[model samples]
Target chain A: MREVVVPLAQRSYTIAIGEGLLDRRDLLAPIVAGRQVAIVSNVTVAPLYAARLRAALEPDADCVIEVALPDGEAHKHWGTLNAIFDALLEHRFDRSAILVALGGGVVGDMTGFAAAVYQRGIDFIQVPTTLLAQVDSSVGGKTGINHPLGKNMIGAFHQPRLVLADVGCLATLPERELSAGLAEVIKHGAIADAAYLDAVERALPALLARDPGALADTVARSCEIKAGVVGSDERESGLRAILNFGHTFGHAIEAGLGYGEWLHGEAVGAGMVMAADLSRRLGLLDAAAAGRLRDAIAAAGLPVRGPAWPADRYVELMSVDKKAERGTPRFVLLEGLGRACVRRAPDDAVRETLAACAPG
Target chain B: MREVVVPLAQRSYTIAIGEGLLDRRDLLAPIVAGRQVAIVSNVTVAPLYAARLRAALEPDADCVIEVALPDGEAHKHWGTLNAIFDALLEHRFDRSAILVALGGGVVGDMTGFAAAVYQRGIDFIQVPTTLLAQVDSSVGGKTGINHPLGKNMIGAFHQPRLVLADVGCLATLPERELSAGLAEVIKHGAIADAAYLDAVERALPALLARDPGALADTVARSCEIKAGVVGSDERESGLRAILNFGHTFGHAIEAGLGYGEWLHGEAVGAGMVMAADLSRRLGLLDAAAAGRLRDAIAAAGLPVRGPAWPADRYVELMSVDKKAERGTPRFVLLEGLGRACVRRAPDDAVRETLAACAPG
Candidate 1:
């Protein structure tokens, strides 16, 4: 198993990565605090692991409330958040009580946001049932619900008490979902670790085949890079924005295409491609290097081009993204592989890249 | 003008207590960072001081979005919180933007909660226009909206960058409103300062008349006591609950009174009498001391008897209060004058207190 501490002092928590860590009583025990725990999962993940999780927590859980919300990123809304609160209030949970998030990013993010706002804030443990949440959303304290107008437009950075990411769960995720998670993994490597990028480049097929050892290492390394950045900038003030390497264009695509229709990882995958193309268009990246990024990303079976979003629609959507300032879209770009900066991608440059990135 | 710092180190901010301090450039200058500032106020407050405050902020505020919400505690809900986010997104506010809260506890609490959750978290300044908000809600970082099931049930301890308590604003306040503010002032004296309680007993009429210096000193002293407790325990983990003084029974009264029926202060005024009477019954206070507490509160023209609420309803209403645990209503009882502790009041004590406090 691999462990990463988020270093937030009192709010500091550990993210455990390995096969079958979900059943480990030691890790989940120290965090849940109470005898009663609410395992907040979604419809998709409840039947799969809820029983095993309940068994694992059965040793200590005095009373358990298993709340299974409907699965899908689209379900990460205010209504879902309210449902979690309702469950907590109905069961009479206290400050000492805890909520266990038992699914992927949507479940984790929505559950965490609910925990953040329920009774001002409460304790919650992140059990990232999907590869995407394990390596990304589950680690950071960024808990929020999405607004109708934009992606992740509402929330708070309330850190979790514990994160138990069992690699075994990834076996249940669809191939496309696995590929989607790889976008974030690839992002961590591209922005902070060239060698990891090289490793993923070499091991794309094996990693895609769901090798447990490789899976643990990739998720852990991604978390390490992210943990370091988040420890310094928990709220995404500066260095943290770099972690959103593809997110600028990614969020725009997600909003433009309509949220939940496209997976967050998929949007980020395509957003990374546009960013690479844009970096090359600005001459900040070598054509070969840019093509290598595109090649590596494409080799992993991810999108190398954004959707057929129009220049104006994409512009309008990007203008509402959290990073925008005075209608200028903020893009986190590569200074080179393993180096990044957050700045506005000039209109002319963005337009040129969009034109170049068009399907031939 | 007197200044009290909550002393939260890097997140530390000052609570400036003075008459006319809201118009003081020096006080507002250090806090106003971003050009696009949103003043989250209500309909009542906006018409009263929004323009004057706007004129003062012209030098600092680049773009001001004044959100005039429906006034009263009933409006302090997630719907109101959503409105703040809607305005921010509509204006495309960046992370650097600051939120200025210009009203009583309701507006201050809701705006602070919005700022805390808006875009993960943003800096906010509290321009508390009500006596209640100025001396109480503005000082504590307890920003949240009320739930249908509870009061201030969902929130965070996200402190403000600056708290501007303009004593001059009290000049335009209604007699009932000013009396309501005095409930919190009385609470400070009851929980932490015997001398201040004595001073409040002597100066109720002058305070009611809105004597500027007396009001300023009273506000400053109340702020100092609150800041001390909060600095030591920002989250109401312990010690800080003392700052809640009459709030245990007080909040129950407000909740039973349908939240907006009785002003928070009016409920608290009656609650203080109940708490003092409960304290005496518990043998922690003398009847003479209790009489003084009740007499001073009555002299301010505030109610000292419980509202026309059934015991069963009060029980159900207070179960949802943040201070309650496992359906046990935790009361801040007086160990002696100006000293308090959170203890589970015996059922007999609460029932008898309610029976004795009936308006009849």
Candidate 2:
């Protein structure tokens, strides 16, 4: 077991990475201060882990409620998020009561957001069950639902009391989902640690085979990098924007593809390649470095090429991204391997990159 | 113009209280940093001030979009909040884009909450047009929509960049609406300032008549008290809970009456009396003091008696309040005149107070 603490001043918390953390009653006890607990999960995850998690919480909590939302990115909107609230209010959960997010990114995001707004904010715990979530989303304080026009357009920066990333949960993840999670793991390496990137490249086979040691090492390293970044820039005011390296292009792909068509990690996977391509064209990154990123993403079995939307359509979709400031789209670009910066490329350059990177 | 600065460390902002501040482009210019602006108002307020506010912002902002939701507390829910997001996304409003809330509490709250969740938070300005909003809601960082089960069950603590409390807007307010606004004004006095309470009692006729000077003084003093509390405890972790004095009972009344039946201030007006009754029964407050508080509330033309619901129903409704902890409802009871404390009274005492305060 490896524990990394995100030092966000008073809001700091720990990310516990290990196997079979779901039954770790000692951990579940201290973090959840209240007697009432609500476990928020999606349909797919609830059937798998909700009961075990609930039973773990039962000895401490007087009451344990479960809210199972429909699974998928399409359901990450206001209506679905409200269902969590409806259940909380129905069960009369108070501000001091704890909410445990018991699924992947969708469940974590929605549950975190539901906790953020439920009675003007409550404490919540993240039990992220997916590699993508464990490595990335679960560590950051960002929690929100999607707007139809854009992905992650509605949300808040609500930190969790604890993030229990039970790598054991990943054993049940589908091949495609596992591959998608690698996108973020790869992203953490590409943006901050060359040595970590090399380690990931070398461990691809072990990662694909769900080797416990390899999975744990990868998740812990990813969380350490993320926690370091988040601790410094909790609100993404400056240094944190680097974490969104491929997210601008990734969000466009997700929104352009209508949210669920391309999974978030898949989109981010291809988006990372496009960003690297753009970085190369902008004279910020070498073609060799860009190729290495593309190779690692492809080797992880995630998409390397984004959908061939018209350049204008891509621009239109990207314009609404959260990173856009005063009509100028700011993108996280690689300056080199293990280095990232948020910058606005010339519109023509961005459009040309879209044209160049489109599936041929 | 009286300005109170809410010192929330880095998130601190100024609350400008005066007459006709909506047209003060000088004040609006420095606060609204972004060139792209979206003004969120309700139908009732849009026709009255939307165009004028837009015109004030025209010279500074390149594009100004207005999203007019249907006016009323019933509309302060997810459906209406989604419309704000729809308009923002449709217009491609970015993180740098500013949202200006141009109405009473509902519009200010919805708009502030929209800005809070819009791209994980954006800068927003509050141009509160009602006495209630100007005096209370607009100054505090409490922003959210209500859930079906409870009032303000869904929300965020997102402070505005600037609060433009135009006492002039109150001139056009209906008599009942004006009285309702005074409920919060009275609450501010009852909880923090015996001198302010005396001033409110002395100036009740002028306040009822919508005298601009009286309204300005009342609003400024109320904001001063609220700003002080909010600055110290932005997330309502401790000191800020006192600001919720009467709100637990008030939210129950509002939720019981189906939101729009009684204006928020009116419900709070009656709730304050119930709280005073509870405080008196608890021996924390004298009957004479409680009577004085009730008389002032009545003088404001606000309700002193709430609906005669069963004690169990009130208990059930109040149980879901944000103040509840471990199934025990914490009521913000008066310790003395101009002093308040949150304590869990004997459940029977609460029930008896509810029974006594109910309309016979």
Candidate 3:
């Protein structure tokens, strides 16, 4: 098992990555003991691991309630979030009750958000099943649902009590989902660690083949990099915006294509490509580094280009993005393979990137 | 002008109480200067004050948008909250935009909650137009919408950047609403200060008549008490629960009668009476002290007795309250006129209080 602690003072918790952690009752006992525990998972992931999690928690948790949310990013809305609220309310879960997120990013974001607002906040544990979640979303306290107009428009910064990332769960992840997870893993490397990017490129085949050691190593490294960024700026005031390097354009893609059409990581994958191209165009990153990032993403089986759309449509969507300040979209451009900066680009320059990367 | 500072470290803010502070753009300029401002008011209060607030903010704010929500507690649900979000997204409000809650508690709560979650938290100033909000909801960071199962079931503790409590607005407040506000005023005294309670009782007629000095005095005092409690325990972990002095039963009344039927303060008015009775029954509070508290509630022209509901109905409702722990409702009962404590009373003892206070 590998452990990474998010240093958020009182809000901090440890992320544990290993095999068969789904059945690790000893790990979950301290938080849920004598308390009613609600395991919120998506329908797809629920069947795969809910029973094992329930069996693990059933011994000490006074009551283990299972709430299977409809799976997919499209269902990440207030109505879907209400399902978790309904289950908890129906069961009379109180402020002291604990919520365990037992699935992928959608489940983790929604569950963390529900914990954020339920009775003015409560404790929650993250049992991220998808690589995207284990490496990125689950570690940071950023949790929310998407609005029709924007992705992740509604949310809160509610940290988890514990994050149990069973890398073994990746064996069952869809090939497409696995690549989506690699987008963020690649992002962690692209923004902070050049050597890790090289290691990831070398390990891509093993990672795609579900090699446990490679998966655990990358997951731990990605968490460490992300934890370092999030630890310094939990609310994305300044330095933390680097974590959204691909997210600005990626969120535009998600909103433009409609949420769930392309997984968040897929949008981010193509988004990172667009950002690198823009970075190269702006004279910050060289062409070779941009090509290297694109190759890594493409080799991971992720999209390297955005869906065909007019520059205006992408700009309109990006303008409403949470990253925008005073209606101007702030792009997280790469300064180099291991450095990122947030700044607004000229309209012609942004339009050029949109035309080249997302030709209609 | 009278000011009380809520000392919450970096989240600390000032509560300004005076005759015509609502029109004081100088106070708001510090927070809203150069930022796009959204003045969230209800229909009733919007027509009355939104324009004035917009005018006050228009001079300094880049753009002042008005979101007139439906009035009353019934509108304190997600749908109404969505209206604020819709307007924000429609106007392309960014994370840097400021939300100025310009109505009563409902507007303050929804706006504060929207600020808490809109783009994962933003700055909001509370220009509470009602006494209930000025003294209670606006001071603390507790902001949320109600779930169908319970009052304030879904919420977050997102504090405001500044609270502008203009007592002059009380002159336009209806008689019943004024009484409702007094209930919380009495509670502030009942929970923490006997001298303040005495002052409130002595000046009941002046308060009822909307005396500016009296209203400002009481509102300032109540804010001081609440700020003191919240300063110590911001999350209601321990000492803060005492602030919910009558909220356990109050939430039950509000939930039982259905929200909007009894204003939160009205229900709390009756709730305080029931809590006094429960305290007397438990021998924690003497009968004379309980009677004096009941008389004060009645003197404020607020309901001293609950609506005729079966004890079991109240019990079932209270059991689901946010204050409950593991399905057992915790009551904040008085130890005397100026002190309160949280504990669970025997079922029979609780039933006796309900029979004595809420006969059905």
lDDT per model vs. reference: 0.83, 0.88, 0.91
Model 1 residue runs over 4 Å out of place are A309-316, A343-346, B308-320
For candidate 2, list the clashing residue pairs, or say none: none
Sliding window of 10 residues with minimal summed lDDT for model 3 chain B:
B319-328
Candidate 3 segments whose C-alpha is farther than 4 A from its true place: A308-317, A351-360, B308-317
Enumerate the candidates' DockQ scores in order: 0.72, 0.72, 0.80
What TM-score do all the candidates reach, one by one?
0.95, 0.94, 0.96
DockQ of 1: 0.72
Off by over 4 Å in 2: A308-320, A326-328, A346-356, B308-329, B347-356
Q: Which candidate is the best by lDDT?
A: 3
**What tens-digit string does per-residue lDDT give for candidate 2 at B1-360?**
988888888888888888878888898887664468999999899999988899889888868999999988878888999999999888877777899999998999999999989989999999999888888888768898877776677888888988888889988999888998888888888889989989999999999888889988888898888888887777777988888788888988988777778888888999999999999999999999999999988988889988988888899888766577756788898988889898988988998998899843
Residue A142 of model 3: what lDDT?
88
